[model samples]
Target: MDLLNNLALGFGVAFTFQNLMYALIGCLFGTLVGVLPGLGPLATIAMLLPITYGLPPVAALIMLAGIYYGAQYGGSTTAILVNLPGESSSVVTVIDGYQMARKGRAGPALAAAGMGSFFAGCVGTLILAAFAAPLTELALEFGPAEYFSLMIVGLIGAVVLASGSLLKALAMIVLGLLLGLVGTDVNSGVARYSFDIPELTDGISFVAIAMGIFGYGEIISNLSQSDENREVFTDKVKGIMPTATDLKRMFPAVLRGTALGSALGILPGGGALLSAFAAYTIEKKTKLKPGEVPFGQGNIRGVAAPEAANNAGAQTSFIPLLTLGIPPNAVMALMVGAMTIHNIQPGPQVMTSNPELFWGLIASMWIGNAMLIILNLPLIGIWIKLLTVPYKWLFPAIVLFCAIGVYSTNNNSFDIWVVALFGLIGYGFIKLGCEPAPLLLGLILGPMMEEYLRRALLISRGDWSVFVTRPISAGLLVVAAILLTIVLLPSVKKKREEAFVED
Candidate 1:
């Protein structure tokens, strides 16, 4: 009954005229960018973070959440139509989706992707609604030591789950922790690494870091690619509906993908990209029905499964951010920045203190999913038309918006320079084969970890054994250690590399 009441309250908040309008706008813009190659939700959200300052918190979060999952819906369109993945999570969709397009079954392929994504998105949101309150209750029991230990688990999970070299991920995390320390100390009010620069005193604007590393960095990289690499299929799309036979084949795949994605999405560093890959791999291993298409050669299941998984993953990845004040991925890290901007501290307290924002954001997701399905199918022609815009024109606009967004955060010009510096550094990270997601996670978690560690020690009078003395903290540390050990095993490392080989 309480759950029903909370949901009713959520709907009341979400159905407001202003909130509904922003949700529509977010879904529309998310699809537009998703249709265009190179631009992704991460960069787009980073660019828009500052703009959320003027919005009511619930409305702002609703819109941002819409953009994140809506991108999943739009990305499959490009993967099927252009043989290009508009979002990294859509990479697997290109294999069978483009083949379906090539075989003139593009309509069925697209319909499957859309239907799968919509179903999975709804299921994921349902899981979030059911589990979020319980998780918040669990989190409320945590003290400083337990919280610190939980962060350790979260960081280690990121390293274990992150693709590529373990050492590189660790190095990036350390670098981010160091960067996060540049601001004044909260306890002492003494500057640590400011070097007397007025701007450095407040530390680096995470908005600047996010925009530079994701927004500007991606634009700069996209600009370097030659025009020949960006060929679009321009073929006209006709039927948008899947046949009854196609629906039968798609239903099971969508179910499996949604389950896998919902579970994986809760793990740190396991987001839409991993969920899609895992779902595709599972579909490949499943035996095909008599007379059905093979794994990669225009298999409708291939399109349906990954699309469902990505969307599901995108929605469920919010679990940690909302429940524990921990961001599970780069995109969630940006969300942390957004929440902080609005003076809302994410975690258990949010549910107790700001039920409207919390439940309203959850309820708006269902509305957003419905909006995406409506927008994606009928507006396919419009999205395809948007693909025709040249990158040459798009890149400058993106760079300009990024600069403006960063500057507006503090109304300071120094942030523009900060963004430029990190833009180069971001490009350098790209060149160096280092992933920046872990770095962003570390930056976001560093200060919180420090505060927790200090509080724990202060409470124990500098006793180093406090973390292990508490049952909850001890369990968390043990989990982190076990995860690190398992990831370090040679056999698991080999398989891990193979899983992310698509990158």
Candidate 2:
């Protein structure tokens, strides 16, 4: 009943004329980003972060969140139809989804992806609504020690959840931590590595690095491929919606993915991507046994699991962010940035001081998800047609939008140059067989790690053992150590090498 009242209050705010319009706009823009190659949710949100300054906080967040998950919905269109994945999470979909398309089952595959995403999204929302309050209550009890421990857990989860060499993931994370150290020392009042540049004193711009690496980097890599190398789907779309049998087959996968996602989503970092990979692994391990359609050979379960996981992960990621004010992943980190921009400090206190923002954001999540389904289902046919567009046309336009988006952030042309540089680096990573996701995870977690590390040490009077002395912190550190050992083992290294062949 209290939840109902809060939701009602949220509706009152979300359903207003202006907020509804932003929601629509967000959904459309999100689909566009998802349809394009190279641009992911984080880059999309980061680029537009500056533009939302003039809008109301709730509406702005609704739009940003829409784009984030909306991409999850939109990415499958490209992956299934054109064999190009818009984001890393969608990569597994291309494995079997494109196969289904080749068999003239493209229409069923697209419809299954959209419908499954909708159902899973709705289920994920319900679970989030049920669990958020209790989790928030638990979060309220956290102190500085617990908070620092939680961050350590987040980093561990990120690397544990990342695919490819764990050593590579750890390397990226360490690099990210080092990059994060470039900014000013809050305690010493002295610049550490400013190199005397005023801009360097503020450290690397999140906008610069994220936009460059993910946004511009993707575009450059795409351009490096030959025009004839593009993947194209048949112009004839098979169907607009899935039949009844399809629904029956997909329900189980959705449930399984949702269950997996809900558990992993609360992890500190790599929630959505981890959930997607985990969902795929679960599907593989269980062996849908070529049961109905054969798993990964255009199987509906293939579409449903990852979609369910990604969406559920997107929804549950808010748990840590809203309750603990600790963003588990980049999208939630952007939300924190958004909230901070609005003069709001997100924490356990946010639920008490700004119940409207908290509940309203929660409520808007359901509404935005509903909007995504309504916005995406009918558009699958249209998106499939996009595959018919020439790579020459599509790649440039994508590159242009990334450039425009990055420039729009600070109205600075320097960002455009940075985007190009990162594009080169991104392409290099692709050629070198290094996964960029861990690097992103590291970059996102670096600053927080630094802050917590410094604070924990400060409390312990510069004792280096503070991280291992506290019970919670020690436990988390131990887990990280175990993960490192397991990942670095010879067998795991061999397995990681095999997976890179897929890249």
Candidate 3:
């Protein structure tokens, strides 16, 4: 009864005219970015973070959530129509989706992706709704020591699950922690790393770092690529709906994918991209029917499964951020920045303190998923047309927008320089084979961790054993240690590398 009442309240908030409009706008922009190969939701959201300052918190969150999942819907369009994946999570889709386009079965391939995504997205949201309250109750029981230990678990999970070299990821996390210490020390009010620069007193702007690394950095990289490499198959889209046979094949794959995605999405560092890869692997291992296509040769299941998984993963990744104030990925870290900007502290308190924002955001996701379906299907032609725009023109606009967005955050010219500096650093990270996601997680969590550590020590009178003395905190640290041990095993390390290989 309480669940129903909460949902009803959520719907009431989401149904307002202003909230509905923002949701539509977010879905539209999300689809646009998803159709464009190099522009991802992380970068786009970073660029728009400052703009959310003027919006009502509910509308702002609704829009941002829409963009996050709506990208899953649009990414499949590019993967199927062209050989390019608009989002990293869509990389596997290209293998079979492009083949389907070549075989003139693009219609059924697209239909399967769209239908699967919609179903999975809805299921993921339902899980989020059901799980959020209980998780919040659990979170409310945590003290400073428990929170600190939990963050340790989250960070270790990121390192274990992050793709690529463990050493590089560790280095990135350390660097981010050092960067987070740049501002004045809250304990003594003494400037530590400012070096006499007035701008460094407040520490680096999260917006600047996000835009530089994700937005401008990506644009700079995209500019270096030759324009001749892109290939579009816009003319091949003939039919709009899948046949009854195609639907029959797609249903089971979608169900399996949604289940896998919903579960994986809750883990730190395992979101849409990991979910898509895992789902594709599961589908490949499953035996084919008597006359159906093989695994990579335009199999409808291939398209359906990954698309469903990615969408489902994208939706459920919000759980940790909302319930525990821990961001599971780079995108969620940006969301942390967004919530902070609006003066809303994310965590268990948000449920008790701001039920409207919490439930409204959840309810809006259902509306957003529906909006994505309506936007993606009949409007497929528009997205394809958008792809035809030359990169040369697009890159300049992106660069300009990033500059403006960063500057607006502080209305200071120094931020523009800071963004430029970080942009170069971001490119360097790419060149050095480092994943920037862990760095982002560390940056967002560092200050929070420090605060929690201090509080625990103060409460325990500097005993340092309080973390282990508390059952919850001790358990969390044990989990982190176990995860680290498992990831460090030679066999698991090699398998981790193999799992990340897109080919």
**For model 2, the run of ten residues with the poorest summed lDDT:** 494-503
TM-score of each: 0.96, 0.91, 0.97
Off by over 4 Å in 3: none
- Measured with C-alpha atoms, the lDDT of residue 90 in candidate 2 is 82
lDDT per residue for candidate 3 within 24-129, as digits (tens), equals 9888877777666665677778877777778999999999888776666777887887676766777788889989988888877887888899999999999999
Clashes, model 2: 3
Per-residue C-alpha lDDT of model 2 across residues 156-235, encoded as one tens digit per residue: 76676666667666777777777777868887779888788666676666666776677767777777776575566666
How many residue-pair clashes does candidate 3 contain?
0
Tens-digit lDDT string for candidate 1 (128-247): 999999999999999999999998998888788777899998998888889999989999999989999988999899989988987777667767778887766557567779878888
Candidate 2, which segments miss by more than 4 Å at Cα? 285-291, 463-471, 485-503
- Deviation (Å) of 392 in candidate 3: 0.5
RMSD of each: 1.6, 2.7, 1.5
In Å, residue 227's CA in model 1 sits off its true spot by 1.5
Q: Give the clash count for each candidate.
A: 0, 3, 0
lDDT against the true structure, each candidate: 0.86, 0.73, 0.86
